[model samples]
Target: MPIAFSANLGFLFTEYALPDAVRAASRAGFKAVELHWPYATPAADLRAALNETGLPVLGLNTVRGDLDKGEFGLAALPGRETAARAAIDEAIAYARAIGAQNVHVMAGRAEGETAERTFADNLAYACTAADAHGIGILIEPLNARDVPGYFLTDIAHAARIIDRVGAPNLRIMADCYHMQIVGGDLLTRLTHHLPKIGHIQFAAVPDRTEPDHGEIDFSWLLKALADAGYDRPFGAEYKPCGRTEDGLGWLKAF
Candidate 1:
């Protein structure tokens, strides 16, 4: 099967218009597109764009509660329980509205006084709401280099949490960039954790640019995914080195 690909619209920006970005993605043969945060564009406008272009939104990153003030994740902190719950609810509502199937849950810092039990309780609650809306929560682990002190920085740790949560609707959003930065044998890891992964994103390891430009052999990696029977979309969540179309020419042959 030809793997379905989705463009992350946020990176396609060039001080140009949003519709132009959508057009570029469609012209490049992307059947689906995802926005990092749809907050700037009215939900009605986003819906209309999808209608006009006939593209489904693969997923959207959840709202962040002012990271400048040091807020990170809702699922792992006690003080932000109320805010975290609200963010999850907001994400679920938006996903249902935009016909998106998944929401990326930002894993915040694990520091300070909050008990591990408290964080687990909140995550369960958030997962329950997501399950009701027919949306899956994608918990992503950031590499320690990019995000220090963040909980769920390791894939193995994330898997352990998913096992603890044990909800069908909650799963890992594996990013090739972070995994490679963390220095792992990705093919072997993917084979071991296939069942827990709900989504996948790709980019060159250190630069976070398009796939073919990186050290990772994307053709082989994508083939590995196909061999593993991964049915979901492989999210193109990378910064375009130049024009989005030029960056994506490699996919034509894939």
Candidate 2:
């Protein structure tokens, strides 16, 4: 069977408005679309775009707290519980309006026991809020190189946190590009965490571009995912090397 794919609007169509990006992804033959922080766009506009394109939204990220200060996320930041929970609330509300399936709760730069406790607490709060709306909560383990000092940098750590929280709706957002850089044991991790995986995404390793130029053998990787029983559409979360639509040969190649 052919694998279905979801376009990541943040990376794929930066030149276009968020709503227009939705239409562009549909035109490119994507089964669905995801987003980064899309708070600037009115939820109604985006929902109309999705309705027009007939594409369901996969997920979107919580806002990166104070980007000017280099805060990528707030969940793991020890002293920002209020901001973290508020961000979670906002993401949950926005996601609900757009009919998204998941929310990626980012764990910002931090460490030590305090950070761990804060992250778990925030995730618990997020999961509880999302569960009511029938939306899932996702935590992605960003790599050290690209996301230096990030709290959730290892899958094992993320899984442990999920287990600690013990929320049925909580799961991992496995982005293969980050995982490959973190470590090369993708298949083993995927199998081990299959029960906990909320979503899957891919891009070129070393350089976050279209999968066609990557070190990863996406054809093999995709087959492995399918063989492992993950039937949901995989997320195409990669920066384009050129015009987003022009760089879509890999969609057919895959």
Candidate 3:
């Protein structure tokens, strides 16, 4: 399976609007693009942008509590159960119109209690709801350095939760940057857990910049994905080093 790039509109349009981001991604030769939060922008506008650009949406996260107030995660275990459910429901409805099959559910930070058990329970609940919508739910782990005290900071732990949830619709959304920050052998882990992976997002390790700026050899990683039978679009979820278009010079070779 040859790898196809999917731009994350969140990064490209961080300084611009969704419409311009879609156009930029299409111009960069990306076949698909994803957003961070659909509710922040109107669904009609997003739909129109996708229509104009002919780019499919790969995935999006469920709505978080507050984007500005530092609340940016969905599955926060037992304490935030009510808010998490509401957000997941909202994201499912959004996905219906945006044509997305997977939604990243952020795991809440552990509160120094029985964190693991609470996380497992929440994951099961989320997976059940996602299965009802005929969509998959992805558990994305942030690095401990960036998100201190976060309960699901380890992909291996996330994998365990998915196994405990025991639902085919629940899986891990493997972000390469976080994986590297957490000090894991990505190739080995990705190969070992390929069956439980729902989607893939990428950023250059160290700088969190475009692939060309980082030391990560994405070509080899992509080839590994191909050999491992991953036939989905690889999400280009990197921060632009400069102008978004200036960072696309390497895609032709990819």
Candidate 4:
């Protein structure tokens, strides 16, 4: 089977507004799209755009408060259970409204046993809420260099969290850009953790640009994913150096 791709609207189609980005993605040949935060545009409007373009939303992220103030995520912060649960609930509602398949629950900056316990508990709650809607809850390990002090930095740690939560709907959102920066063994780690992964995203490592410029060889990696029976959309979650459409030469064949 051919590997599918989803445009990450949060990074791509910046020249256009969120609602128009969905149409832009379809024009650019993507069958699906994902968003970092689509709350600014009402779900009804986004649904209209999706219906117009026939592009399904693959996944979206839970609210990460105050990007300018450097709040990356909230789920793992101790003493913030109320805020975390609220964020999860909001994500679930938005995802359900838009018919998204997965929601990535961000873990925020946190540490120690207390933080871990809080994160696990919050994930369990998120899973329970999302399961009813048939939406998968994903946890991703951000590379420390990019998002210093992110709670979940190791994929193995993330896997353990999923196991501890015991939520059948909980899975990992493995981004190759972050994983390559954290460690170089992309294929090995991906293969070993395949069973726990719900979604996969990619970009050029070091620069976070189009996949073609990277040393990771996404052409081979994507084929590997298909050969390994990964029947899910590969998310193009990167900043385009120029116009997003100009940088899509790498994906022309797909």
Clashes of 4: 0
Candidate 3 Cα deviation (angstroms), residue 64: 3.3
CA deviation > 4 Å runs, candidate 4: 66-69
**Highest TM-score scorer:** 2
> What's each prediction's TM-score?
0.92, 0.98, 0.91, 0.97
Q: lDDT per residue, candidate 3, 1-254, as tens digits?
A: 35788988778756678777788788778888887886777888888888888888877887767658566574765677778878777887887676777878776666544666666676677778778878788888889887876777778877878877788888888888899889668888887888988778888888888776565788788778878877788888888888888778767777
Task: List model 2 lDDT by residue over 49-115, tens digit each.
Answer: 9999999998999999998999999999988999999999999999999999999999999999999
Candidate 3: clashing pairs of residues: 76-108
lDDT score for residue 85 of model 4: 93
lDDT agreement of model 3 with the native: 0.78
Each prediction's number of clashing residue pairs? 1, 0, 1, 0
* TM-score winner, 3 or 4: 4
What order do you get sorting by TM-score, best first? Answer: 2, 4, 1, 3
How would you encode candidate 4's per-residue C-alpha lDDT over 82-143 as one tens digit per residue? 98899999999999999999899999998999999999999999999999999999999999
Tell how far residue 143 is off in model 1, in angstroms.
0.4
Please list the Cα RMSD from the true structure of every candidate, rounded to 1 decimal place.
2.0, 0.8, 2.0, 1.1
Clashing pairs in 4: none
Better of 2 and 3 by TM-score: 2
